[model samples]
Target: MSPGPGAGSAPASLTATDKVSTFSSFRVRNYRIHFFGNAISNIGTWMQRIAQDWLVHELTGSAAAVGITLALQFLPMLLFGLYGGVLADRVDKRKLLIGTQAALGLTGLTLAALTFTDVVNVYHVYVLAFLVGLVTVVDNPARQTFVSDMVGPRLLRNAVSLNSANFQSARLIGPAVAGVMIAAVGGAWAFLANGLSFIAPIIGLLMMRTSELNPAERVPRGRGQLRDGLRYVGGRPDLLWMIVLVGFIGTFGYNFAIWLVAFTDQVFASGPGTFGLLNSLMAGGSVVGALLAARRGSNRTRFTVGAAAVFSSLLVVASAAPNFVVFAVLMPLIGLAGMTFQVTANSTIQISSDPAMRGRVISLFMMVFVGGTPIGGPLVGWLSDEFGARVGLISGGLVCLAAAVGVALILARIGGLRLRISLRAGSRGLALVPRDPEEVTAPAGAAIRPVA
Candidate 1:
C-alpha cells in the first residue's frame, strides 16, 4: 500500500504543504477569522497610539509626557505580567480574552469621551493608559499562547510570523490613516474608532467553533506554580540568552516613540503629520520583514542573535542620517531589521517552550520584552531631553550592539560552538558546529551530527 506513487498524496497533505509555503496559518478556519478580525483591531490600536502621542504632545510640549503615558500603559505589565501569565496557564484563554478586549474598549471610550468633552488632559491620558495596560497585562500572554491552540505546534512559526505580519500590515496603514484623521478631525475620533474596533475581535471569538481548539492542559490551583514556572525557564540557557538579548533591545533599542517625537519636534521641526508618516514608513518595512520571516522555516537562535547585531548596526547608522528625508528613508530599513530580530526571538521562544509551561514562559518573555518599557521609556525620554534625539538614538543602538556581541561570545564559549569552514559541495561558508558529547575528542572536520 505504501509503495504506490499516490499513496501519500491525500488532499489534506497537499493543503497542509501548500499552507506551509505561504501564510500557512490561514489554512485553519478559526485562525482565519481571528486573523482578519485581529488585523482590523490592530489598525485601530495603531491609530489610537498615534493619536494619543500627538494629543499629549499638543497638550504639553514635552517629549517626556508621551513617555510617561507609555510608561503608565506598560507599568501594569511590569507589575502583573508574570501573574497574568500564571493566570493564563489556569484559565480558558478565549473567554479571558473576551473580557480583556471588552475592558480595553471601555478604556478607549473613556479617553474618547474625555477628549470630546474638551477636558482631556495629560493626567486623563495617563489614567486611561494605565487602564489599557492593566487589560494588556492579561491579554498579551493569553494571546501569545492562544496561537498554539488555534494552529497547533507544526505551524506555530508561520502563525507567529503571520500574527506579526497582521500587526505590521495594520501598522503600515494605521499611522498613515491616523495622521490624516488627526489632521482632518481630532484625536478623539481616532480613539472612538479604536473603541469600536474591539467589537470585531469579540465577534470573532464568539463565532469560533470551540470543539476545534486544541486546548493545552491547564495547571490546577497550587502553591508553588509560579516558582515552578520560573525554575523551568531558569533551567534553559538558550531561553535565558534569548530573553536577555531581547530584554536589552526592548529596553534600549525599541524606544521609537520617544526618538520619533524628539526628531519631529527638535530635529526635523515637523508636525504630527510627518511624525505619523515616519511611523508608517517604519511599519511598511516591518510588514516586509514579517512577511519574509513568515516564509522562513524553524526559528533558530543563531539567526536571532545575528539579526539583533545587524539590527543594532542599522540603528547606529540610522541615528546619523543627515536630514529628515534621509532619516525617513532609513526608517524602513531599520524597521525591516528590527522586525526580523523580534519575529525570530518571538517565534523561537514560543516554539521552544514546553506546552504545559508555554503560557508562563511566554508571560515571562513578554514581561521582559515589553515590561522593560517603564524603565526604558522614561529613561530614553530623559536622554532625549538631556542630550539630543540623535545622541539618544545612538546611545540606545550602541547598547544593543554591545549586548549582541557580549551574548554571542558568552554562548559560543559555553556551547563549544566554534566557527568552521565547510568545503562540502555548495556549503562553503563559515558555520557553527556544536560539538557533540560523544565526539568530544574529535576535531571539527570529523563532525558527528551537530547538536540540536
Candidate 2:
C-alpha cells in the first residue's frame, strides 16, 4: 500500500506498508530504505574485514601484524570521533553520509585493484584500511544521529535494535560469502563486491525526502562546542557510566572477532572456511539477541548491567571451549550476550540524550565502543603473539568479568541500593536496603522494591 500523500509521514508514525507490527520504527519509509541499504552494505563491509585480516595473516604470519592492521583501521576513530560528532551536528547528515560512503567505496575499489593486480602487500592493505577507518570516524556519528532524525524518540529503541539485527544478520552471511568468494574467485572479488555494495546506501541516501526528517536545532560551529558536549555527557551519571562500561568491554573484552581469527588460523589450523563458520555462528546468535531486544520495550539500567555480566560470563565459557566444535556451539551464546549488552547500552544512551546534543552523545558512545578497538586490538594481538590466542581470549574474558562486577558495585552504591546476594528457591536475587526506608513513600498495599 502506498502512503497517502504525506498522510503517514510523521517522523514517529508507522507507514502504511510496514510489515513488522512490533517494530514500529520501520514504518518510516526513509528509515526502511536506510535499514535495507545498510544491511546490504554491511555484508560487504564484513566480507572485506574477514578477507583483509586473512590477507594480513597470510602475508606476515604474525598476530601482532594483524593487530597493527586493526589498529591502523581504527586509530582515526580514537583521535577524531569527537570532531566527527561536531561535524554531524553542524551539517546535514544525509549529505555527510553520501560523501563518506563515496570515499569508502573508492578505498574499497583501490584495495580491490591492488589485490586483483597481484600488487597488494601487507603495507598496502594497512594503508587502505587506515583510509577506510578515517571515513568511518565521520560516518559512524552521522549514521547514528541520522536514526533519530528518521524515527524520533518514540521508536528509537526499536530502531536501534533493528539496526543491530541488520548488522548481525549481515555478520552471519558476509563472512561465509567472503569465504566462498575467496576460495573460488579470490579476496579481490570480495573487495570489488564491497565497493559495489556501497551503491545501495548511496541510493538510499538520495531517495530520502529531506523535508520529512526530524530536524534538530543545528548548533553552529564555534568556541567550546566540543567542551560543551563533553560537559553535558559528564553531568549525566547514567550516560557517563554507560559509556565507560561500554568502553571497558570494548577495549578489554568485546574484541573476540580478531582473536577468533588468530585462534582459528594459528591454534586450530583451520582455514578461512572454518573462520567464516565461527563468525556466522556468532552472528546467528546475535540476530536472535537483537530481535529479542527489539521486542522488549525501553532500555533499563539493570538490563544494561545484567547483560554485561552475562556477556562476560559467556565469554569465559567460550574461551574455555576444548575444541572447534565446542567453540562453535559456544559462539551463539557469546554473540547473544554481547549483542544484548551493546543494544541495551546504545538504546539507553540514545533515549536519555537531548535531541540537540544527540549527535555528540552518540558519537561519544561510538568512540568508546569502536574507537577503543585500536588500543584493544594491539593489546590483544600482542597477547595472542606472546602467550597464544587462547590466552588472549581468556584474558579478555576475565577483564570483562572484572569490569562488569566493578561497575555494578559502583552503580549500586550510587543508587543507594545496598547490594546483598540471597539464594531463594535455588535462584539468586539481589536484596536492596534503601537509604531511608522509613522516608520511602509507597502507594497503599505496594510491595517493597527489590534491588537488582
TM-scores of the candidates in the order shown: 0.91, 0.92
* TM-score, structure 2 vs. true: 0.92
Alpha-carbon deviation at 121 in model 1, angstroms: 0.8
For candidate 1, what is the lDDT?
0.84
Residue 50 of model 1: what lDDT? 93
Residue 256 in model 2: lDDT: 65
Number of colliding residue pairs in each model: 0, 0
Worst 10 residues of 2 by lDDT: 1-10
Angstrom error at residue 394, model 1: 0.6
Candidate 2 runs further than 4 Å off: 1-12, 15-21, 423-429, 437-452
Clashing pairs in 1: none
TM-score winner? 2
Can you write out model 1's per-residue Cα lDDT over 1-452, one digit (the tens) per residue?
A: 01122211222322544547657677778899999889889999999999999999899888877889888988888888889989998898999999999998898888899999999889999988998888998999999898888877777778888899899888888888999998999899999999999999999999997766767777787898888988887777777777899889988898898899899999998888998999999998998889899898775667788999999998899889999889999999988999999988888888778877888899888888888889888888888888888888999999999999888866664567766887788885887776666633433433232223
